[model samples]
Target: MEQAVCCYRHQDRETGVRCSRCERPICPECMVSASVGFQCPECVGQARPERQAQRPRTMTGGAVAANPRLITMILIGINVAVFLAVQAVGDSLVQDLILYGAWPPVDPTSGVAEGQWYRLLTATFLHQNVMHIGFNMLSLWWIGPGLEVALGRVRFLAVYLLSALGGSALSFLLANPNAGSLGASGAVFGLLGATFVLMRRLRYDSRPIVAIIVLNLFFTFAQTGTIDWRAHIGGLVTGAVVAFGMVHAPRERRALVQWGTCVAVAVVIVALVVVGTYRINH
Candidate 1:
């Protein structure tokens, strides 16, 4: 019977309802309230411009997605997957992916010095300890979605990656060459910083994020032996700068300024890495 078939508009959706006029199977979303049963979307004849007008939009000029948290969830999943893989493959994975300066004082087999520059980005995803991954993922879940919503996926992703790179670059510049680090802490801190900037842009109360940042900073200093404070501070600073351009750029020239800001930040990050490496090797 018609009731046993799938919806014509949404094949994946099984439904018993059929359009009164078209007599086609219809899902709830495609069904329009009518005099009798329900009319299919096609029968109602919604205008193209009307549908377009109904589309959602992000605050920063990106299209609002149905699932606002999708990117955040994906990031968390990747972090968790990497954590589990580490548990299975062994601790060596951490060394392979972690951000570190030159090694052996002369003969470097691994690290950024030996042309393993991918570590700058890869290190952001590696996590060995359960507590470490747990905390970072929690922070990401808490901070990422809202920023993602405000900035939209592409800009949000740009900020995240730049923040990660910024964190890695600074860590390599200052932290012990041998004392490398790994985790999503940098990206999460970026989101925190972006959140603070966005709150200011939207004229929302910014005190909450500030309080959280202050608390995290205190812990960073208190646990200097464990926490990579350089990455945290670097990500925070980078995220804020990137987000400042995102929310403040003029309407007519927004795209140019926003992307220009990212490119400029990236150049600065590269310069930091180069200068830091030169100092380390010298």
Candidate 2:
């Protein structure tokens, strides 16, 4: 006896769906799925801003609260776990995993030249003592969450690993061949450099960052021994390079540019290692 209702947006089409929020007639084509029920376009448009405002501010889909800097936490966990394993195993782990550049002519057993090049990156996970791991982890904790949120998980990881690689390569080139080094200081310095670059890109005052960097550099060279100043400098510069591209990349081609920059950084580090090895071998 009663006539069927037609959608407000499509008068010719009949529908039974109604917007959950406003209780307006809507066709299937005009429906937008919501938690409770379908919504009309008008309701969706009006509710969008409020929904977005309620959501946490994040550079990527994962929020800091939901994931809590998942990548950063994982890295810290790995470092701490490695540190504990080293303590349990004794100094042998340090002897094997520490970065040893070719120039210093380390013992063959040390594995610098027997094609175990992974030390370039692996050394970053090693630490000399409790103080070393403690300080590095502290610095990572201080900077990691903010940087991870800013760069997103993947890009943040790329910067860290590449900076570690750069640190070892430069340490190899500059340090005595037999000089061995280990720690996440390179990666930690990388975060500092990235933060500095991002702040500058966002047109924010970077003097405090500059001041912190200056203090670190002062401590690096100012230290008495085994400081691996070269590694710190290398990581800082490499991180800045990566961050520069990430910050300046065009929104339309951001992923492509960021990924390409990572590849280029890896290539550069590999090239440095090859050249350094060759010069030392000859």
Candidate 3:
């Protein structure tokens, strides 16, 4: 490095500090603090250098986030917005969006059986009342952010949507063909399941999450006539499997196992939906 008389960015301002990345002379105003010494504004704004030793990662191989709660907040916002839409639009929106294996079972004119397969996932977002949305969103907030931080954004989102899909798939298979169900309970349970898996992975005390799960499962079964326990159970099992892969896969082949778990779960969801649809129609 050549000795310079003044800062690279400002010839008038002299400085002794050099950017750790680019090794350029920088003044106090232009220099940004870095893990090592200092970095110029441009270098600081760029993505972290590919050097493995300097790269920061979350426990399960996710890039550390500046705001871990961003995804959770977005999910909550979406749920609130959808709930408001349901309130304003009335029963028609509910009819169109609610998850059903088949509607008017004798006629079999609509539902997953009638090629409206999107209901499997969309129904998870449709909430009919304040209490329903309130509890589910609260559960999501409590469980989602930490998992998002640990698993990274894309992987965390995969767990959520897939869990929801798993729930819808099971409900479609097991619930009455004419019956309708909607809620984020499946995804919430999924997040809870994933959280428990991570706690076990880290060898932390697992009793708290276990207790929570047992309590929720009891609540689910207690209301079985009105509630679809299948969705909750499906999401729970799927999330646990996914999180196990996320936290336990060998570091050398981590990406393969993690994504393979997601793909495999997705295949199962698709299969369940197909079989359910076939049975409903026949």
Candidate 4:
């Protein structure tokens, strides 16, 4: 018996129903009902044959699905872990430790030796309050994955570290000489700025992103209470410059150029901080 049928996917024709897999119309006599729907005999055989022919693709997809990058997750975990550790150590200790984590340029006259140069980078991993770290880490979690996917692990790490260092350098130059600051907002702002540049370079729609960044900048200036506007500006500019370099550089030389430019910019920032500190001390 022959029955009128329509295409399963397109539903426009009354011709014999096409096979779910191969879309070949089959008369009732040739159609076979399967677990999902009716499949033509040719389709069933072809499905099996094609599966046998391309078995490797299935395996590769499975492998790709299983192996996600662990580095970003590990960094978030460490940040949270350190926050918890600071909490355990108590509040007064946290204040002192946080101050220690901040980068204060060496005073040339008093010869105030720099305690820890690593603080330029490490301070970015610390946050002033639970709410502060929570928000920053959340932003990192949301944006970090996409960036890591686009730029790969090494480049992503470079962008983050350079941005942090840039922020620290700015703070050391512009902040009150006796004051100390620590937070991940600088690095987070860097990621935000880099994202804008990346979207623009890719010719992706950027209206929403521009609005968000503008609002954040407005909020930074509006809010008082020890907010480090200088650090935010520094990190944002550094991230944008680095992202621009990456987008323009040749594919093979992009990573090298991006990293080199970031390092060079960081050196210039450090020099400026040193010069500023000498001027202040003298």
Candidate 5:
């Protein structure tokens, strides 16, 4: 009767085959075939040293890859940098003085004093305090990656710029003649709004995002400290409209339609600003 083959590593029974690297008898289970011959578990471990010696020393270079969140961070950095530069050149009080902090109706009598016409858009990027910019940037950091990945850079930028414009326009329309406001909240809100639409279209779970947006809206109206509810509302509405239009438009007609829609929105916003300016001046 033939004896049963045993594992060479175990050494409890008859030899099945010899280890390839080690010429030792191995059971079928323990036998490991290598290029030269069957190898035992011990031989495999020993071979690792030789393999390691042959491999390249530097597994990865020192250069770090950029994280997707970096873009939003860079933007926040630029804003802070600008603010710091402003403070360094002028008094700390000057930061508040020039902050896109102008009211509507360029005050013809006062000769459009202090707040310049360019501030409408510029102000949206400025923040009053560290807490203000910090929170806004935090929101951008949390939400930007997903939107940027989904929409690609160009569309994401468009959404942001247009939303900023929308927010500024709303502020122009609804703000008190003398009230001045500045912050990235409007554009941030627009990003939230756009993401909300995109997520819904992709059939992603949007309940959490929707809840966040609603809460922000509630806070916009509920909180009393320098919140520009008009800008928030305007950005929200404009972002949703732009997102809907972008997503729903026919693919073949997307470029033409989007450009046309943007132009039309711009015209309307410009018209509103002009009308408001005239009203304030007259």
Candidate 6:
């Protein structure tokens, strides 16, 4: 005989419906319409806890099924993977990815700069060594999620990437052309600056952020040769500018203003790089 097909709740009433979540047989009377499909009462009751467990969490909100800080996690993963690859391949990876001050600029080692301009962005994903990557990754982990939540994923990513470019542009203008620089320091500093601006916007006590920034700046300058102060300052300034635009944007025109601000900042950074490069070449 064919297996009996009946509602779990009402065996006497045969029905084709099933709980979408648990796949248990359900009668038309027991069917509860959901966004996707019908569900039984028991499944509906269990749904809340299941959703809570399945959802990704944001720093200051209820769990949502949408991935929280997904970009931040991806960034961390890429950096870690690059670090591991670098460990395996050695200095060759660094040489290819490291940001030199300027393309076509004179260099002692290679005689002339041959690295492509994309190195500016790629360099942010590269690191000098374990300690360097460790500190930068730690800073990203601390500041990334909260900022990601506040800005939303795309905007947060924009701030990070633009800040990295800003840092590299500044390094191009200021650092010795022959010197190689690499790491996520610029992006980490960008997150710090964004956090500072956001805290100020929310009228939260921003003194602690200021203190952290100051402490970091102090280390940046004090370390001299080891630290790239130009990159730090550039990233900080870019992130602050972006955050300021985000905070000050008119409620009715927020997205436009924020994105426009990012575009404007990018154009300015590019112009600066071109001008600096021209001056250096001439």
- Which should have the higher TM-score, number 2 or number 5? 2
Against the true structure, what is each candidate's TM-score? Answer: 0.80, 0.80, 0.83, 0.68, 0.68, 0.76
Q: Residue-wise lDDT of candidate 4 within 13-40, one digit each (tens)?
A: 5555666777777666667887777797
Reference-based lDDT, each prediction: 0.84, 0.83, 0.86, 0.67, 0.69, 0.81
Task: Name the regions of candidate 5 deviating beyond 4 angstroms.
Answer: 1-71, 91-116
Q: Please, what are the lDDT tens digits per residue for candidate 2 over residues 9-89?
A: 999999988999999899999999999999999999999899877876344222345575788889999999999999899
- What would the TM-score be for candidate 5 when compared with the true structure? 0.68
Q: For model 6, how does the per-residue alpha-carbon lDDT over 1-282 read when each residue is reduced to its tens digit?
A: 877799999889888878888999999899999998999998788887977677663322223326667988999999999999999999987887786665444532321233256877888898887899999998999999888887777778889999999898888767776678778998788889999999988999999999999999999999968788889999999999987887778767877888899999999888867766565556
Can you give the lDDT of residue 207 in candidate 3? 98
Per-residue accuracy of model 3 over 170-220 as CA lDDT, tens digit each: 888877766687999998999989999999999999999999999999999
lDDT for 37 in candidate 4 is 70
Answer with 5 or 6, whichever has the higher lDDT.
Answer: 6
lDDT of 5 by residue, 158-254 (tens): 7777888888877776676555667788888988898888878888899998999999999999974568897888788777777776666666676
Write down the RMSD of candidate 4 (Cα, Å). Answer: 10.3
Models sorted by TM-score, best on top:
3, 1, 2, 6, 4, 5
Look at candidate 3 and tell me the lDDT of residue 122.
82
- TM-score: model 1 vs. ground truth: 0.80
Cα lDDT over the full model 3: 0.86
* Residue 3 miss distance in model 4 (angstroms): 57
Clash list (residue pairs), candidate 1? none
TM-score of model 3 relative to the true fold? Answer: 0.83
* TM-score preference between candidates 2 and 3, better one: 3
Give the runs in model 2 whose Cα sits over 4 Å from its true position: 1-65, 104-110
Find the 10 residues in a row with the least total lDDT in model 6.
106-115
